[model samples]
Target: MQDEKLNPSDETPKPEAGGAEPEFDYIDAEELDRLKAERDEFRDKFMRALADAENSRKRSERDRREAEQYGGSRLARDLLPVHDNLRRALEAISDEQRAQSAALIEGVELTLRELHNVFGKHGITLISPQPGDQFDPQIHQAMFEAPVPGTVAGTVLQCMADGFMLHDRLLRPAQVGVSSNVG
Candidate 1:
């Protein structure tokens, strides 16, 4: 016998007289279905991971914006007392005191005006409620309640101190006296 190399292309399929030879296939229907299922699971996992990354990015951006807007809230809160004191000093000044020290009065007035300007520039607003206005617990704190004749209950009898708002947030509630009268 002569040595020969068998070539796959040279082989011919043989069939029986009444039946055909079955073609050998590496992958069957069940294995194909399994591969499709595995691919679908991987795709689903990848989509979930992608969505999580997007959500995280959005959350980080929102936090950064909030920090930028409200970062100085503590400092702003600390300065409220100074503003209150300065206003009280001006209010306590008598006409005789103003006449005696016109320059001092003017200086204090200028300082107070400048502080108001700064507050306005920084989105800080004053919530000054007048007497007889409706008392709102949302922005006003009841320091005291008294029964006053001819005054409706829950009305603001007196505004002891002004409230402050930084942007839309309350830095401090306005201190007030509410009427406890039934009328």
Candidate 2:
């Protein structure tokens, strides 16, 4: 039998079923620069978008913490007047009245104590400034200033209405009368 292989000049080749992609052998310098710029622009935009997403996530976490810390402030402030009324009721009772109505006084006292306990359980604290104590602007609001004997200026002469705080935030500032230097 004779050899059957054909020479390159004598035979045509058929294309493959799935053709391979063509390679870029030589690109123009200006075209290459334009392609690089487009790539860089897309990369910069992607990086900026990622940074913005990260910042938004961090901000939302901070906002959530603040909301949790100060969420109950409004309700706690509303309850302040009730606490004042209860305190006033207790203070209004004299020795004779207390003795005459021992059972009623006991009930009222118990209720007040229970309310205090509840406040304590919920991280609520009383900002009760006592006589001769230094007045603090952060937790005390000066309702009026007066000259009092044997007290320095800015001293808390009396706390008119007690303040309350929830956690680390002030729910209400204590209404107070402070001493002035003026005679």
Candidate 3:
């Protein structure tokens, strides 16, 4: 019997139903790409939400600090009238009466001193402009400008109303007359 020669293409390839072509479930490449993209998008959205929550927390903390700093603003404003009343009482009492009634004057003076001490403790400061002091627009409001021959121009001639400061911030500006050059 002659030996039968086998051609390379004459061999029948077995179907991949049994051997190791990695038994994988059929999945489309495009569909896989779409799924991966969706996962990435979800991850990005979660990160953004986390960042927003952190930012909101920081903002709330800042607001809380600001509230603490300015919490007594309304109360401070209301107490201003009490200060005004104290000043008025002192002014209303004449020097003759003060001399005649020493005990009454002393009591009034002591009360005024106590009030000022309380104001200082609460970070309230009086801004009383002395005559001939330089007029500062930031701290003083010019109610009127008048010519004064002796005093320098732009100097405070008189204070009509006392100003006040709460810490470093102006509570009220001093009302004053500014001196001008006399003709």
Candidate 4:
């Protein structure tokens, strides 16, 4: 067998000596340019895919956090009326009625306290605005507008019912009567 002469395009790279760079004498200029362009295209696609994957991961994480924080919103809303009724019952008990039904009142109080504890544990918080406080539409609902003595307009005349919040979101706005007193 004899050594055959090879074309420039078909030549294999020789072993490097003294840390010299490998020669690309085997490839024509057009073919080298083509390979460079192909490499650049692949690099661009890889970068875009990496960015998309990162964006998708971030979006999924945000969705999961929101579900964890606000998933029980409906149940929390439904339980509000029960809390309101219990509070009203306690408020309606006169001194004579309280003395006569001490045990029943105590039981109701205990139940309300337990409900409050559960609410606190679940990140439920009360938005109880007092009369004379400035009425904020974000957390307070104007049930009615009425003129009152010694109060400016847009002030809370009365908090008809309390509001609630779960984490950073508002569960319910505090129902209130706003002072319609003209400035």
Per-residue accuracy of model 4 over 1-183 as CA lDDT, tens digit each: 899888999976676886676765688899999999999999999999999999999999999999998999999999999999999999999999999999999999999999999999999999999989999999999999988878999999888899999998999999999999997
Tens digits of per-residue lDDT for model 3, 41-138: 99999999999999999999999976765566678778877877877877888889888988987887888799789778878789999998999999
TM-score of 1: 0.83
* Residue 30, candidate 1: C-alpha displacement in angstroms: 2.1
| Candidate number with greatest lDDT | 4
Best by TM-score: 4
- Model 1 agreement with the true structure over 1-183: per-residue lDDT tens digits: 999988999988888677888678799899999999999999999999999999999999999987877788898899899889989999999999999999998998899889889888888899999989999999999999999999999999998899999899999999999999996
RMSD to truth, every model: 8.7, 4.6, 9.7, 6.6
With a 3 Å backbone cut-off (N, CA, C), the pairs that clash in candidate 4 are none
Candidate 4 Cα lDDT to native: 0.95
For candidate 3, what is the TM-score? 0.68
Q: lDDT by residue for model 2 over 67-149, one digit each (tens)? A: 88777778878888888999999999999999999999999899989989988987899999998898999999999998888
- TM for every model, in the order presented, reads 0.83, 0.79, 0.68, 0.84
Evaluate residue 83 in candidate 2 and report its C-alpha lDDT on the 0 to 100 scale. Answer: 88
* Selected candidate, larger TM-score, 2 vs 4: 4
Q: What is the lDDT of candidate 2?
A: 0.89
Instruction: Count the clashes in each prediction.
Output: 0, 0, 0, 0
**lDDT agreement with native, every candidate:** 0.92, 0.89, 0.85, 0.95
